[model samples]
Target chain A: MAGEREQPAEPLTLRRVAASHAAARVVVSASFEVAAGEIVGLAGPNGCGKSTLLRTVAGLHPCERGEVVLPRSRTPAGVARVALVPQGYAQSFWPWASLRSGIALAASGSGRGWYRSAAARAQSLRAELALDLDLGLRPYQCSGGMLQQAALLRALAAFASGPEVLLADEPFSALDVDVARRARAALRRFVRERGVRALVVLHDVESLVETCDRVLVIDGKPWSTDGASEGVSTARMVLNARLGSRRPDGDADAAAPTTSSFGDAMARVLGAGPHP
Target chain B: MTKGSAGRLALAAATFAAGLALWLALARSGWIGRTLLADPIDVARALAGAFDPAAPPGARVLVHAEATLVRALAGWVIALLVGMGCGVALGARAWAYVLGEPLFELARAVPPILAFPLLLVAFDFGEPAYVGTIVLGCVPIVAITVARGRLGASRERSELLAVFGVPRSVRALTAIMEVMPSCFLAARLALSTSLVIAVVTEMVFTPRSGIALGALAKEAQMSFETDVYFAVVVVVGLFGYAANVVLRAVERRLGLERSTST
Candidate 1:
């Protein structure tokens, strides 16, 4: 007889979460839940609080009215449950710290020992991401694309020590097309291997469709927009349309019906097609 | 060595030779009075005499150099501590930065020499007045440079730390570590200013001991020993150069400049 797999209880839950910067609201009120082993893409135009929403979920930004509940693992007392790959390589890591030092510090912060094995993990992840750079190099010495890869590696190192959810804000925005494709594949593989849930904020629509299990759209700046419109329900509708009409490997086949279907779905939610 | 480095070394030597040649020509020409502008040979002799213990009673050049160095170094260390402390405090809090900025700006503009009279009255021509002059000259530059560097630290980096639940103490320490490169660069500037202020303070407010190169220069001027005055000035220039060389080595050893873009 085959053994039944156990499912995790709500890995991440956001209830009526609202964030603002001194009266100018960003994420008005967003309520959503991400199940374990799920990849959710947050799509929106520039300045529409996609980054803000991710930050709020990551607990970096304080939610004014609502609550963000992150599921805790059994051990590791003080480590955070959510890991973030912040946007922009230049803004992500300390310029003075070598790639190894920064990742070691992050791993140590996540309740893992800063040991040789941790460094070996980081070295392998750097290779897996096709970074092809020495771990001893500082962020300043690396090119923009290389730095972005390093940032992803650091996020993975943090995630290695049992962070339930990964919050990635524009992780691949700085990469070239070929590198982006490789990064997307690596991200998918890494997340699957760890069985971690992720909420990725992306402007590139194709990668979103390729990598994410479900897609969520936030219309016009969430915080300042007057009426408290339906947030999670609208995302649910898009997700349903995306899943019901499309196959998981639709992006691989150029003529797959789901590609056009996904594009059309995005057109309605994003006020434009995938290119936007 | 690489060709570029070799060329650079040659060019530097050439420039120094050219400057010395020009100085010699001017001194030999006697266009200016010899008493006012000493010849290079006489200046060299005076420099040698300065280090000789038996040259004169109460006129050993080492004594003046030591006194000036002690005062300037004390002032520089104080500036380093105060500047970094105030800069971290101001950078950490937005309100404190806003409140402190204008006061720092105003204080920075007032020349240290102009404050000497006030310092003299406050400390009565003592060591306090001399050290205060050096601090006033140096502290503002160091503090402002450090504060700006601290403030310009990337918010995304801070958010990265926050996401991993790094403790606030670690975050603060990391912030300081990042700012150190710029701080050392500022220290070079502060050090030069402290040297200038130390010498000027010694010159303007004559100490009762009269044990400073600037005081020795004043005495040399009165006695018409123009070569001795010029030698003392050369020593002061060399002191500044030595301090800068030390700072550059430190920056290299720490790899601070190597790691930073600017």
Candidate 2:
């Protein structure tokens, strides 16, 4: 009878999350959920609380009033299952630590055996990304592109031991077109192969269109668009519409068209244009 | 040797040679008294005499030197632990910084030596007094330097750690590690100051608990044993210099020197 008892499933959920700073509340009563094997993207302008929302979800920033529920693993062993790849990969990786040591620390924190499992994951990721450098190099020795790739690899190695969700905050900001595209492709393949849920924050609409299955636009709040490669147009339209309603002046129309053009170009890029 | 090390050694040798030449010229001209300032050879002889097996010099110099080292190290370690902790706490909390800034500044502005009389009254002439003098002298310097270094750590690094859901202890460790080179530099400087304070306190207080090199030097001065006094001064100087060199080596091994040099 005990063996026959059914076990409950694990889910990562956020409810009514709100964040405030010095009388300015950026994210108010926003909620989102990511099931296993799903990739969600949060896209918005620079001060749109995308990063704040991710931080709250990852349990990095405390919500003023909200709940983040990370369901326990089904196995007898309990684990708080979440990893985050922060923005500015160069800054995230410890400059003093070698790539191997840094990745090992990250992996060890998750209670995973870092020597064998984590090393294999790192080597696989390096091979996946086609990185020429060995694991012993320090962060400062690597270029921005290399560091970004290594940061992603570190996150992957940490999360590889079991089925766990990941939060990546602006993984490809300030990168040139070629590297950004490469990173996006690498992330997509890694996520697909691992079958892990992720919420990636993106500043550029085009990157979300290419990498994310579903896009959630956060201006002052959260809004979700349909899941499709072509849905980027829909997401952009919603962004402009929200921006226009907030502005309401004649400048709204002028700004709307420029943003729309930019979004459209982004959509085309995401839709299958050559790497810029 | 690396080109950089070679250059530094050459510069050091050149400066030493020039200083030696000046000392020789001065001694030959007899402008400065030989008793007051011995020639290089005479100073060397005095150094040899101080440690010579045949003469069997008094244990006073060794005892005083050991005492000074013990007091300085004890005070330095205590100051480092307490000061760095307070610095991290203040750096993490803005209100703490606001509340503690004025007190810290006032305490730092007052030199440790100036408090020797008050400490003497409280702790009396003994080990406690000497240690108190050193701690009172060194803690504020350590605190100010560490606090400043902590404050100067990159905000982006904090945000990055926060975004990763890192616990508070992990965040603090990372932040401290990020700024450790700066803290180490401050500690090195504080070490030199601690030695100076240790000597000054021993000299001023003249504690009867044990032999003190400063007190011995003072006695030599009164007795006009200039060679012995100068020899003791050179020993203290060598100790300080050696300590600094050791710390510099540690800094290099920690990779702080590379970033600093570049």
Candidate 3:
């Protein structure tokens, strides 16, 4: 249920949100709810509409049949209600706009009168996210992983002051192991401290099991008829795991099971091919 | 200068010298008729005489240059506004592109100068006709280049703005900024075309008043003042080169020197 604008944060609910590309329906009435302060991981097979589903929730993709009833906004008029960290990190920024400009643009809308200017708003977001990087650097000048972090920063900057949700698609795919670990902590702290919800489509079972408060397996069916639904309901929407959120010590890795022992059931949901 | 640039400069100077020598030889041999070609020295003297304050008012090339610049720039501004606006619109909408692309292509296929007669009929013989001619010549090229630039913009950036709910004004500004390189190219091409079309129209129809470079060329050719004709040719060439240099400097200022179509 959506909380009142001035009330405490409530869950972001998707009521039969369906999306199609051309004639083929990629998502078939996929319904789910993500409670505030929770980090939910979405797992599905490769070529499935996992990314598309995230886009649908973020209001990027067109929802054809149903509505994505967004949570009541406590955010001021200028802030984004929902933000998405889309795939393709490197191309997320134009050659002209710097890392700071990208964030500043999104934050500028939300800053209202709270900040001095767009650049100032961007600076505040960097401080809030605990990210340290040169905001002056262009996307082409930065490494792929750095671009991913920058992309994430710009995403969060939109809803930083307002009550909103973040939908990310494999944000860690570009980061190295060491960077990914730190990113997990920062994300955990942001979600917990802000009491906001985030739904991320994870690439691996380890990340799904360790970082998320809960995991939901969306449909694994690929669009066959060029976005027209074969009208099949073969997907068994499963809540496969109820793993707790990141550990307070910031070493959620120790509490998580190894990839081999996490069981094939979870692996299959994460699109890691069936266990032998 | 760097080795590459120095070498390029040397080669260009040598090529120019060789062309001048060949022209002198052709004139001396009387192979080309005197009415059609002037001696290189005579043309240079006439060119220098244009800058000489003591020269006749008719020989003052600055007045002609000013008219050409004004007419060309006026046309260029109109083309810039119309082309960029249309290009951005067509670029954003696929259906618009589908409907507009064919018309743009058809319009582009016809030489812009060919529209001079139509414009003459529509607007009558005046500065308006000449400006309309230049717009017809260059606007399609600008629109097409900018549309391609819009299409080539970083998709992720576009999506980022869309999802982040950046205001439409912010997004439009971003879109326009992304197409700067292409716009620069279109502007450059349009600048030259505008100059050429302005002169050509002036040549075709002598303005009732005001000095015009094209009219000067036509008058010199009619009177068989081949030296004056060649001097005007040289002046036009210099104008084109100077415009290019200024554009390059502006590109450097904006950090866009590495690309013209990126």
- Candidate that scores best on DockQ: 1
Q: Give, for candidate 1 chain B, the lowest lDDT window spanning 10 residues.
A: B253-262
Estimate every model's Cα lDDT from 0 to 1.
0.72, 0.65, 0.71
Q: Tens digit of lDDT per residue, candidate 1, span A122-181?
A: 887778677666889877777887777777788787644445688888888888888888
Query: Candidates' DockQ values?
Result: 0.54, 0.30, 0.40
lDDT of 2: 0.65
Ranking by lDDT: 1, 3, 2
What CAPRI grade goes to candidate 2?
A: acceptable
Q: Is 1 or 3 the stronger prediction by DockQ?
A: 1
Docking outcome class, model 1 = medium
lDDT of 3 at A234: 48
lDDT of 2 at A199: 84
In model 2, the clashing pairs are none
Q: What does the lDDT come to for candidate 3?
A: 0.71
Judging by TM-score, tell me the better candidate of 2 and 3.
3
Chain A TM-score for each of the predictions: 0.79, 0.72, 0.77
